[model samples]
Target chain A: AQSVTQLDSQVPVFEEAPVELRCNYSSSVSVYLFWYVQYPNQGLQLLLKYLSGSTLVKGINGFEAEFNKSQTSFHLRKPSVHISDTAEYFCAVSSFSGNTPLVFGKGTRLSVIA
Target chain B: GAGVSQSPSNKVTEKGKDVELRCDPISGHTALYWYRQSLGQGLEFLIYFQGNSAPDKSGLPSDRFSAERTGGSVSTLTIQRTQQEDSAVYLCASSDRDQPQHFGDGTRLSIL
Candidate 1:
């Protein structure tokens, strides 16, 4: 079984400020990591994923995340945030060995203040 | 190309009524999934269908929840004797084999 833990329930940042949303996972076996964003009243949109290779992954809207295997963490980061970036972010994990469904975190709500 | 599509963007009914939600996956995608999103439970997988294989129902909360994929394309989620706890946004997603799932807008079901 796989589980994801998003460290923050909510994060408020001023426009143009950098922000990081923390996430950690627990799994008995190797797993694939993913980050998704959901705007108000909309479904989740894939931000990025870490399957293999490089530890750092870049995603849309200038967002990026690094997969730290030793720490069991996949934290999302952005150099500068805009008011439009305010939304809910989720971290998910799936077993690397099979075609399995994703296990998601509770989510972190990012509020960018202008 | 069209993404996953779900019907009845919003639904409201009494606690005992049965409800059905629909989903149409993107053409050519072989995998489909159903999930529920509530206030505290961010996202919970309800079931998944891959090709003609039997769906995985391990995430379903109870027997009142059931889903079926017809003709290996469109899928329907049916909830019997809906309870207040069933009120949530029901989401549908689809993807190619080993690909990331593309999501639908989801149907917000409200039980009165």
Candidate 2:
């Protein structure tokens, strides 16, 4: 079985400032990592996914995440954040090639301040 | 074409009543999924459908929760004798393969 953990429950950062949301996973076999964001009253949108061949994955909306195999971590980062970026973020892990169900983290609330 | 669509954006039902949530996946999306989000629980996988076969229903917390995808397009989730703990947002997602999943706005079910 695979599981995910989000280190922070909430993170507040000023607009245009860089921010990172930490995520870690536990799995015996190789897995695919993903990041999703949910705006107020909206569904979760895919930010990015790490399948293979790349440790650093770039995503839409000026966001990116790095996959650390040894540490089993996939932390999302953005060089600069906007007030609109304030939302809920979730990290998920699934078995190789998406053969299994995704295990989602508890999620982190990103509150961007202007 | 557009994305996953869920009906009845918000539903409020009294305790002990049954509720049904609906989802319409994008055209030709072979994979579909259902999830629940509570106040503290981020997202919990409820069930998945690949074509007409549902091989994984392990995430279902109890027997009262049931889901069915018909004609490989739309899915309906039924909760029997709803409890207060059953109040939450239900989300639906669809994928074409290993591709990223597209999500619906979700049906906000509130059990009162």
Candidate 3:
């Protein structure tokens, strides 16, 4: 089984400032990582994914995540943020193969202020 | 449809009542999944269907919860004798094989 852990429950940042949401995972076998964002009363939208290849994966809304295999972490970061970026972000993981279910962490609510 | 579609954007039912939620996966998508989002539990996988066959159903909370997919297109999740604790947003997602999954707006189920 795979599991995800989001270190922060909430993150508050000012517009144009950088932010990072921490995530960790545990699994005996290899896994794929993903980040999804959800606005108020909306469904989740994919932010980025780390399937394989480059360690740094870029996603929509200027968001990116670095997959550190050694640390077992895939933290999402944004060099510059906007007020519109405020939303609930979730870190999810799945097995590298098969019909594995996506295991998600407790989301981190990002609040970007002006 | 352009994306996954879930019916009855919001549902409010009394305790002990049975509720059924529907999901229509994207055309040609062979994989469909059901998840629940709540304040306490966050996002929890409920079920997954791969062309009408459920290979993973361990995420279902209890026996009161059951789901079925037919014709590899539509799916329904039924909760028998729903409890207040069942209140949450039920999300549906679909994918093509091992590709990224797209989500629906979800059905907010509130049991009073």
The lDDT per prediction is: 0.92, 0.92, 0.93
Q: Please provide, for model 2 over A27-69, each residue's C-alpha lDDT reduced to its tens digit, 9 standing for 90 to 100.
A: 9888999999999999999999999997999999999999999
Candidate 3 recovers what fraction of true contacts?
0.53
lDDT of 3 by residue, A87-112 (tens): 99999998853256788999999999
Write down the TM-score of every candidate: 0.97, 0.97, 0.97
Tens digits of per-residue lDDT for model 1, A1-114: 778999999999999999999999999999999999999999999999899999999999999999999999999999999999999999999885125688999999999999
Best by DockQ: 2
**Candidates 2 and 3: which is better by lDDT?**
3
The residue-level lDDT of candidate 1 at A3 comes to 88
How many Å off is the CA of A99 in candidate 3? 3.9
Q: Which ranking of candidates, highest lDDT first?
A: 3, 1, 2
- Every candidate's fraction of true contacts kept comes to 0.55, 0.61, 0.53
Question: Candidate 3, TM-score vs. the true structure?
Answer: 0.97
Give the range where candidate 2 chain A is weakest over 10 consecutive residues by summed lDDT: A94-103
Any runs in candidate 1 off by more than 4 Å, and if so which?
Answer: none
Clashing pairs in 1: none
In candidate 1 the C-alpha lDDT for residue A99 amounts to 56
Task: List model 3 lDDT by residue over B68-92, tens digit each.
Answer: 9999999999999999999999999
